[model samples]
Target: MKERKGLIIGSVIMIAIFVLMFIKGEPSKSIMVWIAAILTLSIYSFLYKDNVFYKFAEHLFVGVSVGYSVSVVWQNAFIRRVFDPLFITRTYIVNDKFSLYLFLGIVIPTLLGLLMLSIFTKKQAWLIRIPIAFVVGSYAGMGIAPSFQANIFEQTRSTLYVTLSISASIMIVGVISTLVYFFFSKEHKGLLGKTANLGIWFIMIAFGASFGYTVMARISLLIGRMQFLLHDWLGVIK
Candidate 1:
């Protein structure tokens, strides 16, 4: 009885929203507006309580997203990168000698990729490690130098290259103090203890700023949804 009453209330609310949308919204955009409104409300249903409507909306979103991603990968990656290079395109047209290099490039990667599928077979499962190792090693080899340059070298250089201005001086001090706070080689006593205490203040300030930024981002999303509900669905605002 409780579930039926809740359903009845939900249906009434949806009907009222639909009527308002149809009355106020543009005729040309009515169908799309209705769809967006319904989906939005369906997702929002979770705020009240977990229900069949919310589950349906959640599943629908996942299904559509996966289907779209697959289509994109098929068109953009598989067909263009793999199929065309390996089979459809003719490298010999440009230079007969270069054909072997092009063929090997495609064959090597394709075999490596296919080796990943060996995991499905019990006997051939060990073969999957070869591809996995190759992928991991290649990624690590390519990423390490750039990651180190960006994170370590660049950050250290920037910290040391501080200007004589008040803001820059404060930043330098804050950074040094923060580093000292994390340094546990010696006991944080006397001057080092005071600096470490100052570092805690800086860390708290950074955390508060980050939390404020996150809240603003969430509020921005809420504003966007409100704009859609008003301007697009009900035409209450331009």
Candidate 2:
């Protein structure tokens, strides 16, 4: 009963927001802005308790966003940017001059769409492999270039450097330190071991600083949302 009440109340507040903005408001644009603000803030109400209300609202929001994106893409990109340019060329239009790349753009998506249809048919399952291979090949090519640059080259570049920048020196020391820390393979009891211990501290401090910065950014967003609700939504502040 309590959960139901919360759900009902929350839905009413949400509906009121939409009604105020869309059906009966002067400067509907301003009301729409507040409606968005209130709806966004409502998600945080989950921290207070578990309820069916929150679940429904969350799923509803996700469905709406997905549907909206598909609608916008159809209305704007597919109709205006693509369909209009390709098939509907009228006055001063040269269909014979159309680029082959535009055909590839259509075919690639069409191929993927066809591959997805294969899932619904038992005999056509083999057709899925082409799109899968294309996607995987593209991903592997992207992954290998970055892995080579960062892990392979950057990690080993210090040994060949005649003069080092601060960043390079840091990287070199980090590499040397890691090597020393793993000296269980032999024995690191000299200055090498000591340098490795210092490197371990640098790694720890770097991670800690990164974590602290992330927390500060999230807190800043929270404060901004509060200010919006108080000042802009309510008109309670000058």
Candidate 3:
């Protein structure tokens, strides 16, 4: 009972805050930027810990977003693309007086909608098997069919390098040396072992680069939020 009450109170508070913001309208032209800034910071606080306020804010954000999406999808896609055309072109297309084959475009997709009924019953699911087969076949043909050349073409390309060029030879040697490093049965004493050491260094450098990029991305979001609070919320110019 306490949990339920807590949930309700949290939800109501979030909804009320959002509703008040909506009703208040934008605070000047700059308020949009400021509100965005604060909300972003508040939301990022979730990465640290879970709490009632975070859950409340998150649910509110999702609910409002979904509501907005529902409104937009119906208004933009269904209405503009499907509804309006059906209304305007219904007579012309349905009566077969048009040259555009519009009826088939609408009718074919609508007929395919029968496949959705397969979701309810196992027997009807077989009826959808044909469309599924077609989709799967086409996708395999386009995407994974070339994977047959994976070993031959890709491997051969890696080996086919400019041995005469200093930089190219160095890169190729480095790669080969790195490859030899992973054969852990051998002792680290000779050229092969030293090459493996260089490979490890390269791997570490690459990993560090990737790590730095990820940190920069998170920091960028944080910086953007901070900037928004000052320039947007407080009306302080950057």
Candidate 4:
């Protein structure tokens, strides 16, 4: 009963809005605006109650997002990296001659990519693991050295070697306490326990700040949507 009433009310409101928009708004742009408005309202309908409108909007959003991502990847990754460099520029070859080394550079990765499609077949499913392992190992090798330098060495150097000040001293204390809290070799008792307790305070403060930042970001997005409806669609704000 409640769901039926809500749906009827929503339909009536949407129809009335569309009629008003069609009468007042420009024909071509108004049609697009109407669609944007409907989709936005459909998404917001979830806040009131779960219904077909919300589901439709969610599925449409996911489908469009996935389609756009695939197009972007194909153009940027494959077309630019593989097609342009090999066929157009032919930068990998010299004197219009075949070079095994140059050709293998592109061929090996291309073959590995094609092998990924073998995952659909039961017998050749194992071929997919070769490319997957290559991708994982390549990323790990590329990422580890820089990550170790930035996260470990640089942070340690900054914490220990930074000029002494109130803020720096606080940071130093926080780092030590946090490390001590994670240290399980010695039991967290007496002085160690107090330091660990201090670490808990620092952790909670960090978490609270992060949560507040996230909340503010969400609120900003909500404000943007509301502004669009009011100022852009309804012309209620300048």
Model number with the top lDDT: 4
Q: List the residue pairs that clash in candidate 1.
A: none
Q: Taking the candidates one at a time, how many backbone clashes does each contain?
A: 0, 0, 2, 0
For residues 1-238, what per-residue lDDT tens digits would candidate 3 score against the true structure?
Answer: 9988997898789657655654554433665665565567467657646766578678878999999999998798666656666776473364456735775665555456556557679767777876677668878998684775785677658667456788778667666766777778878778867888888887777799999999999899778775555445544444
Q: What is the C-alpha lDDT of each candidate?
A: 0.86, 0.71, 0.69, 0.86
Show model 4 residue runs off by greater than 4 Å. Answer: 1-29, 84-93
Can you write out model 1's per-residue Cα lDDT over 112-227, one digit (the tens) per residue? 98899899999999999999999999999999999999999999999888778999899998998999899899999999999999999999999999999999999999899878
Question: Which prediction has more favorable lDDT, 2 or 3?
Answer: 2
- Model 2 regions lying over 4 Å from their true place: 1-29, 72-86, 90-105, 120-126, 150-171, 179-200
**Candidates sorted on lDDT, descending:** 4, 1, 2, 3
lDDT of 1: 0.86
Candidate 4 per-residue lDDT over residues 147-177, each given as its tens digit = 9999999989888898878999999888999
The TM-score obtained by model 1 is 0.83
TM-score of 3: 0.55
* Number of the candidate with higher lDDT, 3 or 4: 4
Off by over 4 Å in 1: 1-28, 96-98
TM-score of 4: 0.84
Best by TM-score: 4
Q: Which is the better candidate, 1 or 4, if ranked by lDDT?
A: 4
